[model samples]
Target: MNTKMLHDSICRRQSIQNDYERIKSSGSEANSDDDDHEPEVNVCRISAIGLFVNKFVEGCFLSMIMGRNILYPFFGIYLNAAGNSFNSIPAVFATIWATKIFSAIFSDALPLFGKRRLPYMVIGWIIAASFLFSACLHEYPEPYYGVTNCTRNTSLVLNPRASESAFFYVLSLSGALFGVGIATVATDALTVEYAKREPLKTRDKVLAYLNIAQFFGALFATILSGFGLNSTEYGGSWCTSYIDFEDILLIYGVLCVVCTFFTLTATHEFPVDPKKLMPIKDHLAGIWKTVQSSMFLKMAVYIFLSGCFADVQSSASVKIKAYYAGVQPITTGIVGALNSFLVIGSIVIFTKYFSNTDWRKVTIFIKINIILLTAFAQLITIFDVVRNQYFYLLADETSCTLFLGILIYIAINLSAELSNESQEATTYGLLATIRLLTNPISTAIGNSVSAPFDVVSNDRYIRDTKEDQWSIAYAIIATHVVNSVSVLTVYYFLPKNKFELNELKLQSTHSKKKGLVFVGVISVVFVLAITLIMLSAVPQTQCLQVVGGQGCSNKN
Candidate 1:
């Protein structure tokens, strides 16, 4: 009887394994978004591997590029040294917006070449890395000055601020390239295309892994940036010889090139017949139809409102680094790496457990608490009311708040329901455009409000008075408070149920009317004017006739 029981248990286990494989193989038929057929098992396996490798390699390349930008505060100092600390914010916004616009345009157009995304992906990576490489050509007139407020006799005298150079413009050009080259907005659509080939259960698992991998990539980038770019200790100095921006770019560029090759070789996209490829006119029509969907509009509005805060965290991190004691380049890097690691952990937890639940109440409650705590943290720091070091606490709070605040996953799901697989790239790209618009708007508001109070605009961390420090802190606090309000909209507006077919079939005539065209144009004009006017108002310092430096090109 014991032998019989053991044989029965083994038989049941084998049966369960075979059933699981059948469910996976039948996924395409059950969740059929585009077609009502089954994909061959071998083809499905190949596609899954391709997607995994593509994402991993993309992550590696992204990490290398981000490593160079680990010293954003320093970059801001350089801009200030050039006489207008805020000059690049507008450019950054414009480039990002333009890239989204192009990515949408290209996503549809590139299919004409018998390919959809892979070719553009390769080209975009190359362009982004190549332009970032231009930073290598930049050389500060003086070496990077340590920002210490020490009054000790042995302390080094404050060096003059770096003067503006053609290299600055080159860096700007590179940013534009980067803006166009970082083609991540299309990755989700690609993932969905592959997921469509699998069954429901298998698809969910694949998507979860895909998201985890992306977050892991971002975390890796942060860690890589921290240690790869800056020299933590060199020749007994905290600040010593390290890789230059250009050198970092060169390394990133090479890695991107290698990754691009891997992507092209490893990934196999479903073949599209030339006859069936959507023409330019049809593509535009599809985009218009997708835009008209109520789901798309709501998602866009919500994402725009919440996404603006995404840029604020970095500036806030910079503030903490500037004010906190002993928070040098290495410290900033370590904190960033740690924060990213936590972000990855948060993503994993949310994807696995919290994602399918109606967490609306929970999310709002958390946001409210975070806002209060964040306000308190900033206020105490600004008022000089507390001498205790709370950098880690503040960073942790900021990370948790952001992770809970934004609802990109929900937005993406909503978008997918409104769009067919063919138009997924354009649909998601449009969302990306909305998100990109937030960057400039937030930057303009943040900088303009803070500009009047910015007393110490150069590279030095010293303040003549504690009031100067208060101004920076207040600006950061105000920005946070204003942006935080947008998170509440998600709780209020987001639907409780996953999108269904019945909702898609309903035709709302109101959606077809292009209402935002005039308002959007006006908004664009206004934002550009505000950003340009503010940046121009900041007085630029004239370049001294230092060797290998241009001596004041702009007389204005």
Candidate 2:
């Protein structure tokens, strides 16, 4: 059958099957004689082609994370060590961000080409791979620059400085192009297409699963960078020790290409006649209409602000590591994993309990609380009430930072969900655009805001120095305070309604009862285990330090 006919057939069969299942489960009995004469149930099956397409898309996602998260950091470190300034790093990233604007525009336009998603994805991947490969060879001396005349003979002299500059330019350009190809409009569109098959009730779960997959991909990248790049042991020579970085980039590029091919080969689109396809102008008009919605605008603002805060936090990662000189990359990876774990848990819980309630109120409340908590954390950090090591350890062990992160993440998720209930893909695309726009702006602001403090405090020179650490703390506090107030203002001015509280109460009670019982048993076991470990592990001086740190030395 033709593609349209096949789609119609599938739809009819699915509808009939659903109706039959509903009747069967409702305890309706069919006449015994009529049962034999009934039409055969045609099971709705996902085609082999469909499965292949899904897998291919998933693989591309996996590869993108590997390249962006895993390889990029190592590349950044290498470029920095090669005499590039800290400022240059942001410029490189900014270039990547700038390219995404073009990617977004192209992605939105590609469907007009009459080709399916696969061609766009394939071409993008090819571009990404080619640029990445060129980036790998960036350190090679330029032929023209190396040509020199010596005494009575023509000779070649390698200009290492010229080679370094050439390499940096190539690396930056490749990174920018890669960002344009893989991370922009195509990813958002793919995610929306995936979610279209799922019911609204399961949509959040589907997104959570995708996010989880992305997190796992990031985690894998972190591990690969730690081990493959030999970051700790071989800190020098981008071309030498960091060859694995290029290898990873190439691998991900190959995966992207292969997956794109699979997607093309396996997926078929039902051909829409010109009458059926939405006109380009109409679609653009719809985009404008969607953008003008008050809810969408509010959500867009909230996400932009939230992203600004998050960008600051992300930029602080290197600085955090600098504070703890002996900390390993593996430790950082573990912390990241812990954060993801907590975030996943929070999303699950929120979906289970708060989903049936009014998301708007819950989102607003959460944003307010996030601002409060962010401010509080910053205040504590600035006042020296929370030491960096202790804060990091607490964040690591108990997932405190993860908890806070999820509070903010859930707000953004709910806001996005609420803004475009009907046109989710477009809503999310806009949200992504807002977020992308904010990232570089926020990063630039954060770097600028943090610079004077760094210079004045001479934080780099001081090891184990508590005096100068307050500069960052103050910046964090100021930013969070501003963020909180802005959200509060938005919450106040926007519409308000009493969401049903009883369902939430019931869910809370149920969860609390179960959690209390579980925690009580676990607490006893945990106390015993900790006591045992402590008795075995502690020395007298260390015990005193631990006690003092806990503020229990005098209490006992």
Clashes of 1: 3
The TM-score between candidate 1 and the true structure equals 0.75
lDDT, candidates in the order shown: 0.50, 0.43
* Residue 198, candidate 2: C-alpha displacement in angstroms: 3.9
In terms of lDDT, model 1 sits at 0.50
Candidate 1 minimal-lDDT segment of 10 residues? 541-550
Number of the predicted model whose lDDT against the real structure is largest: 1
TM-scores of the candidates are 0.75, 0.61
Q: Write the per-residue lDDT of candidate 1 for residues 1-556, one digit (tens) a residue.
A: 3433433564576567657756875675555332323352233354455556556655554443333234343453322232223333433534444355557556755663567777776766667666656555655444234344321111342343343443464354446345334455445567667655554323344555665565556556555555554442210123444554445556656656765676677676667656656877887776667666665666566666765553443233344434443234444456655655565566566656766556455456556666666666655655556633446444444445355413434454455544556776776667666666665555545544444444224322344266666666666676676757766775765555332222432433436565365237436744674455444334442121111112346233
RMSD value for candidate 1: 9.1
lDDT of 1 at 230: 49
**How displaced is residue 33 in candidate 2, in Å?**
27
lDDT of 2 by residue, 1-556 (tens): 4434543565576667657756764564553224222323111223224323333334333333322334233433332211112222433343344345345444454453574344555666566656656655644322211221211111232332432343354454446355434443455455544554444334555555555555555555555554555443222212224445557656555655665565556544333235533455665555666554544454556655655554443223343433332233444445555654665677667666655544456546656655555455444544446646435434433334444434544544453344332233355555554555554445445444444344222133234356445555554554454455445444543323112211121222123344344335434533433343233123332122111111224323
